[model samples]
Target: MQDSSRFDNVISRPPASGDIVPISAHPAEATSAVLHRQIRHDFPTIARGEGSYLVLDDGRRILDASGGAAVACIGHGDGRVADAAMEQMRSVAYCATIFYTNTACEELCRYLVDSTGGHMARAYIVCSGSEAMEAAMKLARQYYLEKAQPEPRRTRFIARNQSYHGITLGALAVGGHKTRRQLFEPLMPQNVTRVSPCFAYRGKTAHETDAAYVARLAAELDAEFQRVGPDTVCAFVAEPVVGAALGSVPSVPGYFKAVQAVCRKYGALLILDEVMCGMGRTGTVHAWQQEGVAPDIQTIGKCLGGGYQPIAGVLASHEIIDAFSKGTGAFIHGHTYQGHPVACAAALAVQRIVAEEDLLANVRTLAPILSGLLKQRLGDHPNVGDIRGRGFFWGIEFVQDKTTAQPFPAADHVAMEIAELGVAAADYAVAVYPGSGTVDGVSGDHVIISPPYNASRAEIHTIVDRVARLVEDYFAAKNAGGPVDAKL
Candidate 1:
């Protein structure tokens, strides 16, 4: 494979004082101290990116594996996306959705609706995934209020534990991860409950059948709705394939179908937060389509504009839209950057490329290549406890013992180690999107591997090979009575 660190630019490379950063890398001491997420060594400042490679400020080129948390779907330095955004900016840059709408917004909405199996209902463009989640919560509630069943449906939402919705107050309220919610638990809203995730590796009981597991989770949802008083619940939310919070774990067969049935039975709308898993990350245009279930309300972002411009949108089903259309004619929500022409135009360009090039096929084909390569390369590694994922999205979960499926100690910083290795040892800049609480809310460690849809085979191999080598080396050094040096 080509050298992963052949970048063309450089910024904050390691200082001579040694690569060990303080706990926070607080500034004011020596070299440029920036408390980066991964303190492997000083991070190289990226100058530019092209295709699936990030050009660092120091003239080194690095393979981009996870697409910056799976955001850069179309690879880097795409002139077409730039042209589209520039054209929209020249025409109309800002028009808040509260006052009026623009042609780009209208066209983008139409494009999304037509692509989503013609049942788009409508689109509400927001600024980010967290904002989209916040919008989805409010919108789901409004749908019922407009339908005149506000009292019975105002009580709750059912989300899965180890699933990430967002960090906003309402989104975090329904988010189930314990550590994320521990500090502000006293400040969160009531009525939102979390259920066990559909993870088979960790959550599945020994000797339990997949059918039985799905049935059990479905029953759990039903019981939660009943506990909250079924008539008072607004929505049951989950990622079609859980991301970040639980790596890339998908539910067992019939999981969504069964869960959807429970929501139908309880008269609560089903909300799928595909912020990290949707928009062809899982091969299909929409992740929910693979499960044979559709969401009443769905939130999608990340790949929506392929990171060319910040954009997120909630896909409302026709029924959800009709309730508001007939009752209030307004959704009772507002955003200053909603349907910003530049974001919509950028998204339109991305969607057009995806459709025209049939990139979903690329995602489908490359997914197996990526998954198989990772497995074929590192399947027997003792530290790799599990390899799970779907589509272009994937994850590698580490454990102290594979047979017992034991995660490395969190303080051991397994995920953080691999993340730093990507730079210090391999010269790659991939994403460490998910980690922590793999066994619970604070003990396990896993790293997400979501390559760009436009990544080439050479780049993917570099990513896989380097990551495997890095992980193996870290353990090897630690086993040899060393500190598992972060400087490599």
Candidate 2:
């Protein structure tokens, strides 16, 4: 008999029930002592890695595809590589580059420079990919300064959309990934222009010829250069193969040649970021080799040390180094860990194994087999719209329909769902690098599967089989009206 209005005024009403509450102090989401060690992962805890399998702390042996984002080129826990690392660590963990030099660092530098086909005169080592990219940007900027272009010959950077350089300001400025830059837009550098990426699946018109597509893209670059004013442009930066931003998308033939010509015409340095696709992951020692052009500056990471140590580096052409030499006798961009001894040692061991074992041959041999298997199994998959990639690295782009080529809605989380199913039901611990906005900057989904270079035939087959099953099952569940796992 009480008034209905009074009863409806309850504090825990429906609308208020789900509202967020403000608390002055609270426990952190990441708890436990191990949380301090690494706050990123929840410890799916891999107990061990043998060959290409990761034995999780839960006793599941998951096939390690994508080699931890193409970092583990060689198989995990390789004793020979381990022994090399231990040897160097015991001999000398570090040496200050400013005052003295170490054998490990000097030898590694010489090896990389020599391996660079007489192009890279010098190599500088750093801790990770982001650091390498930062160094590349600073180096490129300093090169222009050293050349005495006092009026600031370069003010704009031309990079393609759906590209990822790194996380730091200078590198991030040229990076075109929307999701990653959304939060940091305020602090990013100005005058960096985003051009169209050489992505054919979404970008290529149905009736357009490959040659026409390349021309169109080249024209777009020219237009962007004009918009920014040719002399005002500093560098043309890109990943030889689009990595996290576009899921291993390679450019069409004549694409880079055209782009390179344009960059040269504009006096902009061409920076190729091979952080995820270089160092034999793409079956070639250098991804740019297939492109028929050489970059003025190149950045490499991840597989450089094969995850043996956190190491990355930049390779500079003699021209850029010469400019610096003639002017200041230095590049004027130096990092404390610019050439860490231990990192160089670890990368040397990894590189030696790749060369001695003839692993590039392995990469070439298995690439076709993996691609064939992916096509044979999931090529016709309803949910799998496109199967595209090269070398041992591949990506399965999911879509609503293959005929229409319409992507699954982003809210469906199709890529994430497929990733989870692949992990749980397939028992394959695949590294999932997903890309959104493939259609534009916001409307597509895909997953990358880059197996280690040393992965065996059986491991490769298992990866394909498991991932195929996962993709099939994901669609089955989604159509069945069951809740799809949203963790891709």
C-alpha lDDT of all candidate models, in order: 0.78, 0.76
In TM-score terms, candidate 1 sits at 0.91
Clashing pairs in 2: 66-450, 416-488, 437-442, 437-443
Measured against the true structure, the TM-scores of the candidates, in listed sequence, are: 0.91, 0.90
In model 1, state the lDDT of residue 435.
66
Scanning candidate 2 in windows of ten residues, the lowest lDDT window is: 1-10
Q: What lDDT is reached at residue 306 by model 2?
A: 87
Runs off by more than 4 Å, candidate 2: 1-30, 33-41, 148-151, 426-431, 484-488
lDDT of 2 by residue, 429-459 (tens): 4544555656555567777888888778887
lDDT of 1 by residue, 256-336 (tens): 999999999878889999888898899988998899988899999998988899999999999988888888888888888
Misplaced by over 4 Å in model 1 are 1-19, 22-43, 148-153, 426-434, 485-488
lDDT of 1: 0.78
Deviation (Å) of 5 in candidate 1: 23
RMSD of 1: 4.9
**Top model number, lDDT:** 1
